[model samples]
Target: MSRNPSPCLVPVSHANGMDLNAQLVLDQKPIRQQQKLRTLTKYIQSYPSGWKKRFELAKLLYQIGQWQQAIDELSYVVRRQPQVIEARLLLGHLWHLTGKEKNAICLYEQTLAWVQDDATRYHITGLIAQCQRRWQTALDSFESAVLKHPDNSVHWLLLGQIQLRLEKPLAAQRSFDRVLSLKPNDVTALIYSYDALLQLHQVKTAEQRLQQAYKNAPSDFRVLLRLASRRCQQHLVLDDERAATLELIRTVLRLAPQSAEAHHLLACCHVFQGERIAGEAVMQRFVEQYPNHPYGWYFYARLLFQLGQVQKAADTIMHCYQKQECDREIYRACCEILPAAGRLKLLQPMLLEMVAAFPMSWSLWVTVGRVWVEKFNNYELGIAHSTRATELAQDQAAAWFAHGRVLMLAEHYAQAIEALEQGYSLGNAGARLQTIAAGWLEECDRHI
Candidate 1:
């Protein structure tokens, strides 16, 4: 029997514009196998109806990276012998590798209908769910697979991964534990288990797991990077721990010199350690190296802001915004710097554009409303933006409070009282905001 073709043989298009067929021709092969392939091609041409010979030719084509030709031959074999399960599976795999996921899924579903084995059925169902990105469905399928074949560590590992994606950290930890039980010292399982622990906020346990992983695989870049990030996130005040964190990050950089994540983390460490000059230099280099990386620019801008270069910081952040790298952090940073720099008038047009772009962002709307009310004294425009903020974030106490304050300033006492009361009822209004709202309400009542 011919060996099953390795999945790694899938052809990848290269940057140099050389086609897969050209690469195949350039590949060196044993002379005997090349001669045999030529002979087999001619033989298959002579006996076109020979399904067995055609299947053999398909496997050979697959081995030699002739994916399209292999798929053609396999399709022919499956057409002639519809019950050939191996050939059907190979063809489906080839279809998946060629990016014909729908066709591959159809074939897998059809095979599942005929397959009596529960394990195979679950595996196929899991594959279909994965193709659709239905994490819950994949989790169900993988769980079923595990129930039928409890010894399969691969199934357990996949189940753990899906559980993690679904944020079922405890369930993922259980699955990873099962995987580790089956395959002791599996590095991937260890890393995933550590992640699950971290998600559960079991920080100490996660640290212990990381130490074990580091001891087991000292040179593993992923383990080193995770350890460094965890340490940095702890915001360690002790000198020794901070020094160790820096050392770990530097080691990761040495191991993977081109790692963007390592550079980002190292820059963050510098900022955390109060080394602003070093942080600025590292962050500048990082953004230059990875201009498309939003976090790089975001952090660099933060360093600039700290160094009192408010204008340059604002410019860097604006660049990030132009690149469509708008997130909560970026928006919040802009809200802080623009107002402090007394550039609210200069930022008004951009804020309006951002509000349009991120209509759901209550913060953006509130910022625009505040600018209109405080900077320009445009009461009508301020009320309009503040009302929109309240509409977008009905549950946000800050939104309601802001709207109510604007209304009171506009001297719409009744509406202001109602808005302030609504803000008070939202239950998260800070003490200062609640007191101000109460004082305003008293003032409104006096007006009434």
Candidate 2:
């Protein structure tokens, strides 16, 4: 009689095949992943009740961004093994990633009930609170997490961030201090602590924290930028601090040679130091290098204006407008600069083009109307454009106020009062506009 075969050796061939398929998935290359999927499908078909194989397949699918397929596989695995906490947690994470936050929260809450470990419970509570934007709840959960897992610097950091959002700067500073105690070279904690200290008006202490952060990450652009800004705000009478500010800006330029922000800050530093020619040169170079960037063009125009080149400034801003870089600041700058250059006519064509391209822009229509009525004394054109603005943006107080002002200027007292009263009723017409409308209403009553 032969000895009974060992139980482990009975399924050695199947075990080796499964191991090979798992290894192929681990390779993570596209071709290997495809091969692994095919092998896993055949393996599952042969052993239809294999939840472990299905879970492995789900992980690989997730790595490849096949979210729905991953979800289906994980769902099957969870149904087959209801006690598999890891699978349920991963399914919940997928739900959160796909923006099904409520589903994720439900799963996480269920998992919290099953988990006995305080650390796991606290982590799940923190995740739920974060999804709800309940900052105080998140802070309490993170505080508990740090208490249970005192070595976790990340928990402390998150707790500090929540405290900051809740406007308890002192509490936030204390939490950041704990993070720094755990990790002295934590640059994020250093920076955040500095901010909290500044909010609390502990200026000297904030400066020390910032210095420590700089020493830890000398080449960090954000740190350099903040340091330079703080120096500028200090308005130092001492030459050393002023020189240090310039050096910080120079270092930023050196570290990020192609950075437009660095160049912008450098130009500003030069201007602040009263080196107008140097500032102009730097700003001009920035605009040349990054012609499509609106800020570079804006700064360059400002430099031209400062240099008394009003016509050049107007031309630069007009070019910006032609490129469709129109914002409130750009419009305001053009209104000021073009008039000063005695070239208000240069902007009329641009404004007309803008309104034609963007017919729904109420503010552009108002600008065109104001330019006509105030700058050129063209009352008929002004009234027509302002009327068009009111039609397009009936709820906009600016449009109503502008129309009322134009009607008042045309000496149409009754119509002006109607428009002005409509604007005043909107309640969000800014203080200046409201004051002018009120005064104009009095004038209209006198005329009536």
Measured against the true structure, the TM-scores of the candidates, in listed sequence, are 0.50, 0.40
Q: In model 2, where is the ten-residue run with the lowest total lDDT? A: 4-13
Q: lDDT by residue for model 1 over 359-436, one digit each (tens)? A: 555656776776677767788888898898888667656677778877877778799888988987877554556677
Error of 1 at 305 (Å): 7.8
Off by over 4 Å in 2: 1-116, 236-243, 253-264, 275-448
Q: Cα lDDT for residue 250, model 1?
A: 87
lDDT of 2 by residue, 1-448 (tens): 4221111001011211210000111224557778888898888889889899999888877665566788899999988886788888779877766656787788888777678888768977987887665656787899899899988898889889887665456678989999999998887789889888775556778899999988876656657767876876665413566677778878766654545555766676677678878978998887776566665676678668877889899888777666654665577678668988998667677667656654555666767777777888888887888888888767656568778878877777799889988887866554556777788889989988
The best candidate by TM-score is 1
RMSD of candidate 1 to the truth, in angstroms, is 11.7
What shift in Å separates residue 140 of candidate 2 from its native position after superposition? 2.5
